[model samples]
Target: MTDEQPDRKESGFKETTRVRTARERLRETVAGHDRTERVPLDAADGRVLAEAVVAERNVPHYPRAAMDGFAVRAEDTFGASDRSPEILRSAGEAASVEPGAAVQVHTGSELPEGADAVVMIEHADERGGDLEVFDAVGAGENVAPVGEDVESGQRLYDAGHRLRPSDLGLLKSVGVREVEAYEPPSVAVIPTGEELVAEDPAPGEVVETNGLTVSRYVERWGGAATYRDVVTDDPDALREAVERDSDHDVVVTTGGSSVGERDLLPEVVSELGEVVVHGVALKPGHPVALGVVEETPVVMLPGYPVASIVNAVQFLRPATKWAGNLPVPDPPTTDARLDRKIRSEPGVRTFARVSLTDEDGERVATPTRASGSGILSSVALADGWVVVPEASEGIPADEVVAVQDWEALP
Candidate 1:
């Protein structure tokens, strides 16, 4: 084994602790390199743009009327209201021609020459071809001037922006039909273990479900997922699998991350590539292996379901964002008072499952007992997870803590 490998006892526990700040680990894992590609605007939904999108023309290119009313000078009806009505000739005297005239206008119609404002049709009455206006209108009212919605030569969107429905509408309004966006990164997931089988497993073997979980998350974040056949603790088979799938942006393997006698993922990765970070300082996912195999990033996740998921959130999400030329949003969180006390190690950050409930008009958090990575059911029942940092020993009851809602995942 290389000098970077941690010493593990027969009981599956490490001899020395390897603690790293979340930011440090993330920086060490990602090197900021990215691959770019172009895609059609219709398929660019939720994808990040690699270049800035400038406006070709101003929105609503012409000044137009916003309501169906009489276009007249504000000075014509200075005090015209319900109490005092102003009478004026509808035709040649005030310049009128049915609905399309120099004085009368309809909704969204162009303003006639010499007209500056529109008085609602309801506010005026016909009196022998003349009009009696009761409401006073202001100049430039009910009118959308040119370049009011969008200015000419404006920077509509910047690079690294993920397109949403509203953003698509803005692009369309500005006459942009296509865009240059980065292609999503492709991720290959390899599940390892002898007793583990596919979802439909044989007798005495457990079904492998971590790949499915990982794949779902990768696609959710605009990354492609590729699932490979299972490798049963054989270093040569694992090496071959990594080599075959080296074209992918990221390769994630479940199980065999620790230094157990049967665990050989670390050794295989070292032989094929260089291991940058052998372990993390977080609970339930400390044995994670982060490295690069032939210029492609590889992450070896722990076997337990919960541990695998936590590692994905911490490492895989950021890596996927970097590869796809996207920016990762801050993890969704809400502050709530803790209902019970929770303990943790001083050097390791702990994630505890929690359920939120309203009590006395305030949110109270109730923690779950499934703290281990193997217990997947507990996570299913939890609304979110509360984070405890590395420097703190434990959080006391009624302390406000940040909780991540599981439903926020797409």
Candidate 2:
């Protein structure tokens, strides 16, 4: 709350805010929204649970055979061997196993009553209505007892746990039909700029892609995104757009955030609400801004494609997670050796796109040729990006670094 506010009409930031401070303020503004909904198990994957899931019934309601075998009393198979096999009368699928009698059962079949163990068909021989066991069996062997997989009243998952494919399967096995899941945050993605068009852009006119890109990412990050039409850089239109979508959990406007005269999002946002952060000390996206309107967090991204995407990952993603009561997942990463040195500003964090390759016997990361913020292909074709800390000037060649997969979802 104490961060100095940049002048709305200022052309550039004298001192940018740290990435951590911007994120903290953004999270604080959007946190504590606890809306939830009942979601069927089929559609619950990747959703965050709103409450603990308890098993109401055992996974295996009855004791069953784990594999195809003959059910027999443990005592009947004791001392059984190839040289002196123990012989028992065949019960032939009887409802229950009598002492010294064996009942046939298949995999997953209910274990016959009175059967303490199972002798595999491979270890037993059938001869004139008699079964000869050549292997000793212990009680409960080759059988799946009741509650073996999930016991009744067992807590399967706690609040904030993200559901996966296997998690849904297990929940269904325990008689769970649906789950109480946090509702995804709603976002309005508005791309601004007078020179932006939808398609078939002529000279000096750029196709409107920042909104499309940011909206898609909003959905991928577990937010319901309403992709709005491209709004002109006029202050009145920009303010109207923000006010129109203020009901949403978050409002993200891409472009028109820089210091150029055409860049007007920072000023527009200031008029309608308080801008928490005007610029961040991050490479390629320092013009990004964060604000709050009617208790809803607003994220203004840079006009450049790469910078917009980078700021979305840094600010919008976590804000959406906080609003939806979902836990933010760490991006997936891989360790690789840098093929070449990467220069970076000492006081700014940098995300240098790189393509991974195997050279000789080592995994090497080669920086992309088009590393500028406006170069969409640089990030499009890159496998991941190597992060340079604010304290480091550059990473030397052959140094091992963790490459973060920007598109990965947890």
TM-scores, all models, native as reference: 0.88, 0.96
Candidate 1, 22: how far from true, in Å? 6.1
lDDT of 1 at 327: 80
Expressed as tens digits, the lDDT of each residue in 177-251 for candidate 2 is 999998888999999999999999999999999899889988988889999999998989998999999999999
What is the Å distance of residue 318 in model 1 from its true position?
Answer: 0.6
Question: Largest lDDT belongs to which candidate?
Answer: 2
- Per-residue lDDT of candidate 1, residues 317-372 (tens digit): 77877767778787788888999998888878888888889998999998887677
Off by over 4 Å in 2: 1-3, 6-11
**Per-model RMSD to reference:** 3.4, 1.8
RMSD of model 2 against the true structure:
1.8
Each model's lDDT comes to 0.78, 0.90
